[model samples]
Target chain A: MHIDLHPAGTAAALAVLGTEISETIGARVSALNHAVCAAHLVGVIETVPAFASLLVRYDPLLTDYDALCAQLRRLASGLNDEAAAQGRTVEIPVCYGGPYGEDLPFVASHAGLSEEEVIRLHSERPYRIYMLGFLPGFPYLGGLNERLFTPRLQAPRTRSPGGAVGSGGQQAGSCPRESPGGWQLIGRTPLRLFDPDRPLPYAAGDFIRFVPISEREFCALEAKKEGARP
Target chain B: MKILVPGPLTTVQDMGRRAHAAKGYPECGACDKYALALGNLLCGNEEGQAALEMTLSGATVAFEKPALFVLSGAQANATLDDRPVPMHEPVRACAGSTLQIGPFAEGLRGYLCVRGGIAVPPVLGNRSTDLKCHIGGLQGRALRSGDVLPIGPEPSGTTAESLRHAAGILREKPWLLRPRTAHAYLENQVIPLLRAVPGPQQDAFTEEGMRAFFSGLYGVTPDSNRMGIKLSGPSVQTIDGSDILSDGIVEGSVQISANGQPILMLADHQTTGGYAKIATVITPDLSAAAQLRPGQTAAFRAIDVREGVRLCRETAQQLRYIKELTIHA
Candidate 1:
């Protein structure tokens, strides 16, 4: 995999590890993210991994652009074939259609498929976590069924409930918190995508496989979590 | 201490909630880091300690016990028990004394730092209030009327003793003797000449778009906030369209929207953005961008990355100088 380094700002650089959004490139992005982070070059503040690029923010006081760039190039060259592979798979239980999935019918209508077919298509494969962005703990995944491709709403939804599973433009994402959005919602996951107490579960390169569940089961799990909370 | 009348917007902030950006959280903190640090320095508190980030308006704070605090940034009309207290100096307030910070005479944001600092529980290694997720500082929200904030224990060693006599009155030091004078100067011109480096997508802009970005003076729009400073003026167009693959966004990224109006991302910018960012404001000048008021015009000039880094180093030296000026140091 080839990585192109570009100046993002005065103190940061954008490393384009791959050109397109695909599972192979996504995995490579993860590997580079792992390698660069593991190298821990002086002055590197944080490395943010997105779809196919990593934004590395650094401190100018510790190192300048040329020195850091050379160090990053050297580090990138030595990355082992065996990446710091972390593919911890998470099984998210989701309730499809009805009140929980506000735009299920619309999605089905857009795809010219029955609601069940849409649900089956959505849950059939494991989606790769491309990045975490747009909202806290929100996962930008790439593994939507080609037929499931849909456009964003003409007018954005002012508020999307937390845990709403949505898709738009061949990308599927689950809302980690209640926020305004434009993606068409298909389902809601009972599981919390984010919690301050827990470490961010899905990093770039992790896998997310959704499990379809009934509305009743979703409520049951929600109530169980609420009951467990002190 | 009770807040007699909470300002329209006042929240506790420190450096920022970094590291958490990977989780899509914006590192919301003081918009003006230099001013905040200077205020903390004057109060003999660590720069990272929590301080109040006051908006256009200021709140009336009632001290339960005697405390030492300093104000920085905006030149606000302040009074201590009906008497005016000096800004940028340590002042001691007796129990039940009320500190009122009112409308600003200049600048938009202000910072009020206490001796030990605001003792709100820190979430994720910061006292910054992330209003989006309701995390960090005073229950993850802005200060409200009647809200009481606990003050921490006074720090052990600092310049608090040296400046004690000047308490209740303005600082006695000359303008040159005081620290960080040039860093906190108010703007006078209607247009700010912002220095920037080429963005990752700088090549994506058409020749005309590039020309407009540097040639035109854009006015800050009313729709701007901590998220970003939206500007309205000559629109820049991309030869490859405005869309780009989603990637991480920086605080000073000048993102060109579909409409082509530039939006200067700031303190509370999203972790990642999809629009094509034509340029990025340099680190040293981000403070200037933060103070830009709506309807104010701004222009940009291209500078090499090395020049921007030089400015950043100078800024760091200023911070170091302030630390050394402390009596404890």
Candidate 2:
């Protein structure tokens, strides 16, 4: 993983590149964010991590721009080798039809396939969490199967309620808040992807694979997993 | 406290509205964060304490009881019962005394922070008024006449001598909270140099169009508000047309509409946007952009992300040092 250092006002940022978009990359980035955040500096307040970059906010008074940049470069270089290592793959059960996936049929039709076929194709491949942004816990997963690619809505709706699973242009992610979205809404997840009250949600480099289940099984899981650990 | 006469564009504001960028909400808050910080500090309040933010014209406030207060930002001719008051200084006003903030002789916004902060309830973890969402701060709207706001607890260390001395100096002298000389910081109508990083979708624009964006001067239109600043400038041509996916737009994200004009997102902008973003203004220069009034012409300068972060850190450090000096001095 090669990291490009950028100057952002009074802070320095690390743009991690060349690492394959995978779950391991996401985890490594998250770990780096925590490590940097732990180092309390005059200007370094927080670190905002995105698909391939980590924007660290710092105080310019205590640390000069060049010094912070050097620190980030050093830290990023250390993480480069570790990010290349493999990470755990977590499975997420998704009910792909009915109310959970209001637009599943539409997506299936758009992709020239039946709803079951679309689900099968979607569940068949594993996805890498490139970054977590747009909202907390809203992972920007890359490496989607190109066959399931579809264009977003021309005019986005006023709001897409939380947990409303959506897909667009080979990208799939969940919404954390009620927001206007152009992505093709395929399904809803019972899981609360983002809970700011929680310590951490999904991190970068985490691998996620969808396991298709019946609507009945989804309900049972929802009820049984009420108090499940995040 | 009751608003006897609402000043022009007075709204309750705090530090900012955050985490709603994905929903396309601009992080609208105090336009002059430096002033707001001073006001809060003078009143011994927390950093994100709530206050009434007024623009150009000042509001007339009548107190229900004696309270400790400070006014910062724009230089508005303020008075208590027709007697001239001071700006950027803490003052103690008695119950039933009417405090009026007149029209601004210069600058745009002024912050009035009372001791203990504003008593209004917060929405979405913020008390900052979001004009677009019409939520938070005085019923999510601008201040109006006859609006009575409940005051919080009375402040300690508020005395007649401190109020008189602070107010006298502030009214007679220029603001001491000016930026350091290292930066080419401009005041009033003078626009600062805006540095930006190429947007994620910048490649969608033609190379010529990208060059035009950096070289061109854009005037902020009157249609601009907390949500976005509409700019009149050279039209930018995109190779793939105006189609793009709706995604998160942070504060300072410059979005081009179908008509080809750029709209610079501001504090109250929505979390996500579909318009093609060509550049994102660095965070340090955000305050400079916020102070811009209508008709101000601004130019975008491309800077590497490292430079942008360096500038931000430098500015923040200066502000922190000044804050410490002011408190101790």
Candidate 3:
């Protein structure tokens, strides 16, 4: 449980829990985040967990930087690496190809696989959520199969619709809102990834599984509210 | 209140959404937080009350009903109905009065606080408009012509007791509520000298690169926005390469891009960043940094993190002291 600590800003410090980007390192980051919150370390206003680091925001009025560093060091030492504490799984329905997935064929050719093969390789496995940051509810998903791995587009797209499932640099991401992106978008999901009404739909350490659906099914799901699908 | 002419990037904001960063939501709020806080304070409002935060440009708001409002941040020429009104000093506006604010003579962003506060229902526990996602504020967007905003009930208890002051007559203050942070952004103010602390990835920079960062005068690039103040000047590069596994980004982080430009992350910055950060302008100066517009030159001076923390504490104390001092007003 070696942690490298540095001052993030005047009010906060970052705890880099791991060096490499992997499930093991990510788990350690998640555990340390949970431990610090569970312990209620004084002055901790918020914690932002990324690939293998957790940035803790604190109030200087309540606690200073040195005190926070020592407190985080103490909390990180007692963290359980293999803790069962995890976020719930979310199933996303995708419509690959045509208007919804303009880059589906491009991704298929880039990976040297059939369109069906690309979809299977992507949807077959569950990916762990790293953290949302680039856009609201935009999930940075890990665990993409090497067979379907493809590089980002040479020229980025000006605008992508909400629920765009895109891949770049050995990682896949879902766009919760329409925004400019540079990734190779292979498909689109009907469900709104970032509805404010939904009570914290996703978090770090959560698991995401993709379910493929026909265009007709996708339209039906899009029209229906979450959890009310026929 | 009705928006006759909307300002650029005008939105309802409070202190912002800070508690949910671990879940990946960046805290989006007023770029100049201290200005907003002081504006709310002058209006006899709480620290976290929603206020209209306008950037670069100013908005034209027509009041259908009477309201008490205070303006702060950049200097803007404001008029009540057609008569000019003083800024920083509180004003009690009459119903059917139109308050037209400025083509800013100085500074970038300005804050407008009403007595009850902007009553827009908070999204994710904040009235702030997260422009990245387009949620919250008036229809999750900036103020537009013909949009009506409802102000909330004023909170009880105040120092100056601006809330209790009679509303029919314009209650104008003779003196100004000047905060230390606003000094750097005032018109005719010198090129800002921002005190900085080594960022999380300072080691990523080479010795010469670090020297370039400290010595060079970074000019604010036109690419700047509420998300960050992008600068292009002395090229500051890294030793090996400038790619960090995506990590959490601080609000005032000075991230150096592949092209060697410094991008100072502001209020609406993303929660995590992949670029290598060389330094962070400590708190108490972020407001000054937010007011920087394109073509403005800002230089960094390194300071001890402890001193930065101490100065931040002093700033907090100062705000409290102001609240008490206003008791007699």
Candidate 4:
């Protein structure tokens, strides 16, 4: 595999693995990211793995672009698929078709299916967390059923509550916080996707499995979380 | 110190949460690093120590103990007990004294650095306020009225004599501490020119689009925030539309949206974005870009990586010069 280095900025560089978007590209990107972090290169701050590239942020005073690029190319050559398979499958509890998911009916109608089928299809399999972006702890997931694909809302709500399980086009993920979003919301989770005190339970290469829960269970878990907080 | 009146948006910031971008946390910090570092240096605090970043307007604070503080970035009419506090200089605040920092007369953001940095418990290794995630800095939100912030213990080796001497200088001759160079906004230029290098996705844009980006005068939109500075101007036509497979983003990325408007990513920008970026504002010019307020216009000029690195080094040298000047004075 060959890596192409592009200047993201003065302090950062994007190591493009390939142009085409696929699981192979993502796995290679993940491997390079893991390898870079393990190497502990001087001045390297962090590595963010996306669909087709790995963004390496570093300090220019300690390391320059050419040096970092040469190092990145060496790491990319020996990448293995084991890094892709190492991610844990985190099960997330979700309550479907309620106040938390106001767009459930719309999504169901758009997909020509009942609300029950929608939930079953969404919760059937584990989806890969391709990357986290747009917001802190917000996962960009893949592996959604094509039959369940629904268009995003034309006018997104000004504030969508955190833990919102949403789908737009072929993608599906949870909103980590209360922010404006256009995704077709079909369910909600009580768990906090993002908490500063708690290390993010999931990462870029992890898989997220949605577990269907009743509204009562959702409230109980929600209250338990609130009570746990000081 | 107690906040009597929290301005429009004020948050505690440091150099930002480094090494956390991989987990999708924003590098939230002072929009203008030079200003924050200058204030911190003046107050004898570590360069990356936490300070208060006030946007548009400044806060009114009441100190419960004697403290040494400095105001920098965006000229603000600040006073301690109604006596004017000079910008970029350390001044003393007596116990029970109320200091009011008026709205910025120039630029958009200001930094308030006390000798001991703001001592909010760090989250993810940073004291910065991540407003969206509700993490770090005063419970991950802006300062509110009556909010009492803890000041960190003074750095070791700081003696009472040094504090007294430093505090006395402001009263004796405040102008001695002022930097001779004025802020770029204070200059007579109608539009600030930001130097940038071609971005990773420069090939995605058509020749006309690149021309528009370089030649166009873009006005900063009110919708701009710490996340990104949205600009409106001549439409930058693209080759295959502006959308790209989401890729990693960095501060100062000039992304052109489907509508052809440019959005300059800032400190709080997301880790990744889908729009095509045509250029990245150089490190030295990022502070200048950050200082641009809504309704102001800015132009972009292209430079190579060699020049960008040189400019970055020059800025560091300038900071060192300021630190030495302050020490001798």
Candidate 5:
């Protein structure tokens, strides 16, 4: 609901208030990050939001640890109010099952559901972007329905092709780049979540809802976007 | 211009890789960032300029044209044209002079910086060589014999007059780039107490396991590299045997594998890891950790997130002061 400010060095520590590790954590972290970033220019060089924590890299020369911690605390405590003032949402499209989702069967079986049911459960809920990490523009989506919860494969693939949709535990998201991953892939999204060349990538509080589409619709959207990108 | 013979482990490095840790890539850059800074300062280059990172053994390079260079870091028996050359000081070499680096007497890593920085293509916003992907640096591998490297245009005002002026300032006053001040704690085996802030997975380890981590002595294993350091010490047990989903890991993260041995992730570590990270070393001590050899012993000291932040700020101030002195000098 709010951010918790802890005393850090001369700087103040800013963390997501609750410890209940849930799907909405990323959005909350992202909201807090935007607030803190907008407030302090020198103390905050970068903010790295993880599953449960945000690592803030600051310039010590300009600000001492105590001063920074104080600033972080002040900023974090005000995040909820700031987020309420400016709200935005983003929608994502996905093609579940079939070729895009090779491991659909495995995930369905693991979660004790049929393939169709798995897709229904996955696309039914609106997910929150908990954080952006693991790669450039990689979004960590939270709020996967418990019925869809599944463990990752014991041995990870050497490389998971970029844009492969995957799920693990109660979380699911697509890979932004080819990398070794252990998440159980279920479907793929047509959207490119991260493009370094793009001005604004996915932000933390942005909403991601999977709009199920057929192969034809996916191809049409891809073509339209490609034509527009000249 | 060409590598006569590649020494043991030489690679192109800058200050450190950053903003890419979320993807499982460790900030793999120079083992000694301060030394790299000094090399750059001596050559009147920017802080993050690329330079050759030489390990215990030195490398031999044949220059096609005269170059302004500076050697810093571990004291190495370096020679040019069969004559011994001074280190930590700028030197000018003729076109045909062969620079040969011999065995190091004190430290493990050395840095050789040219006037205009290395001319390698930048990858992912950096020119530092990552040994894992075998990308970056000279053809993504250690420098070897017969490798012709292209030297960029030298910096303006790097003439004898300017160098003499810089040298005069350094000689007249106690320079902030003094390697001894930063490395004083490293002389004896009394490793500086490393402070670590607990991570999200710290709760997974048993209280005793955590205690053992702080109280027990851990030796850096021979397998340690840019990716991670394999620490050998007491076996640590976690609260649950269940595995965790892969998540982002950062430089200085101490990830405990299923086997109970702790692996301290370093620069060039994978962006993400499945193992539970109990703690993350504060950024200030990371440089010291980077310089640790395989046989070195390190002790971990637990500090709260607040204290860790304080240490980071103080260290940053120290570095800034050093940089300011360099500019003024």
Candidate 6:
């Protein structure tokens, strides 16, 4: 793996893998990120990996840019693409249409297809997780079918609750918490993407496949989730 | 300490959850970390000890145990059992005493640091509250009325009796151990000149746009919060637009929106952003950035990255000096 270092701020640096936004680059970035964290170098704090770059924050007082770059470069050389390319694919049970998915009718009408067709196309294939950002546990997924492409809401909703499965532009993901958003909601997930009591279910480089479920199944899963919580 | 009145917004914060940023967690901590450190040092606690960060309005509390505490950051009109308690100096509180802290007279946030720190269960290896994700510190929420805050055990050497003695001696002279740098001059009334260094996306903005950012005066909008400081100023012209592929964002990043205005990312800002960044406020000036209130005006002055790092070292030295002065001779 090869990487280029750029100054992010006074105390942080951005390690760029490549300018291209692809699953290959995301895998390479994730591999290097994991390696850097595992090394536990002094002065290094944490790292956030995006589509094609990883931001590494550190303390300048303990280590300067030159010393830190040498350490990162050394770690990058030891990373293999195979280690990060393969990640566990998690199945998310989603309930499509009706009140759970407020904009499903609109999306189906805009795409010149029936509501069932839209759901079938969306759940037909698994999407690659490029990164998790914007909000906590909010996965940025890639490879959305062009047939389902739709613009965001003209005016964003004031509050959208967690477990909201939505799509915007070319990306699709779930809202991990109640927040103001402009995504077009097409479904709702039964599982919590982010829970304070549980570890984050997904991360960058992982794949998520949506499995369509009936509204009754959604309710049953929701009840089980609540019952499991303390 | 037991909270009698929870005030407007109060949360426990330390140095923040720095390790969880990679996992989509914002590094939520005290907006003004320098002030938090000062309060901790004054109370003879570790610099990163968890303290109650009260914003705008302050909380009214009753001490269930005798402890030495210090109030830092914004200046507040506080009374302990109806007796005035001075800022920047250690004040011993007896058990059952009521401490009423009024709205801040200056600055935006104030920190209350007890010797042992606020003993809240740590979430994700941090006590700082992340309100958006609902995790960490006091059940992942702000302190409310009737909340009972437990204090951790005091460290060696800073016993209740020793603290009582130190408070008495320090109150006599006051000036000897008082760290003037600990005080944020947020009430100066004049527009603060914030120092910044060019960000990675500096080339995305035109020369004229860069000039507008450095020369123009920006007003702090009311929409500003811990997430980011929204600024209203002259439109900064971009090469195409301010939109870019979403990238990692750090505190102090000056991201120009598609509307041409700038938003300074703060402690609770998102881990990644898509707006084009023109510059980043230096680490030393972040305290000043955190103190800027709504309706106030601020200007930016460009500096090199070397100078920015140098200022950070200088701030660290100043904190060490204060630490040495506060230690009993």
- Index of the highest-TM-score prediction: 1
Which of 1 and 3 is the better model by DockQ? 1
**What value of lDDT does candidate 4 attain over all alpha carbons?**
0.83
Instruction: Write down the TM-score of every candidate.
Output: 0.92, 0.74, 0.91, 0.89, 0.79, 0.89
Residue B127 deviation, candidate 3, in Å? 0.6
Question: Cα lDDT of all candidates, in order?
Answer: 0.82, 0.68, 0.81, 0.83, 0.69, 0.83
Tens digits of lDDT, candidate 6, B166-234: 555555755433222222135555667788878768878999999999988899999999889999999
Q: Give the per-residue lDDT digits (tens) of candidate 4, residues B137-223.
A: 999899999999999987754444454455465446544332222232436766778888887889898888899899888999999
Put the candidates in lDDT order, highest first: 4, 6, 1, 3, 5, 2
Question: What C-alpha lDDT, on a 0 to 100 scale, does residue B192 get in candidate 2?
Answer: 54
Worst window of 10 by summed lDDT in candidate 4 chain B:
B175-184
Best candidate, DockQ: 1
Candidate 3 — what's its lDDT? 0.81
Give the interface RMSD values of the models in order. 1.1, 5.9, 1.3, 1.2, 5.2, 1.5
Q: What is the lDDT for A139 in model 6? A: 87
Worst 10 residues of 6 chain A by lDDT: A221-230
**Over the stretch A1-230, how does candidate 5's per-residue lDDT look in tens digits?**
44443322222232534455664455466666677667765756555566655656555546655666667677766656425323355556777778888889999888889999988888887777665655656777877888888888899889776667879777788786677989888777666544433433455556667778888876776667542111
Model 3, B112-180: lDDT tens digits are 988789999888888898877677887888888899999998566663353333111223432223335
Please give the range of 10 consecutive residues that has the lowest summed lDDT in model 1 chain A.
A221-230
**Judged by lDDT relative to the true structure, which candidate is superior, 1 or 5?**
1
**What's the CA RMSD for each of the models?**
3.3, 5.6, 3.6, 3.8, 4.9, 3.7
Colliding pairs, model 1: none
Q: In angstroms, how far off is B210's CA in candidate 2?
A: 8.2
Candidate 6 residues lying further than 4 Å off, grouped into runs, are A1-4, A18-20, A73-84, A225-230, B159-191, B324-328
- Judging by lDDT, tell me the better candidate of 1 and 6: 6
Q: Could you give me the TM-score of model 1 versus the true structure?
A: 0.92
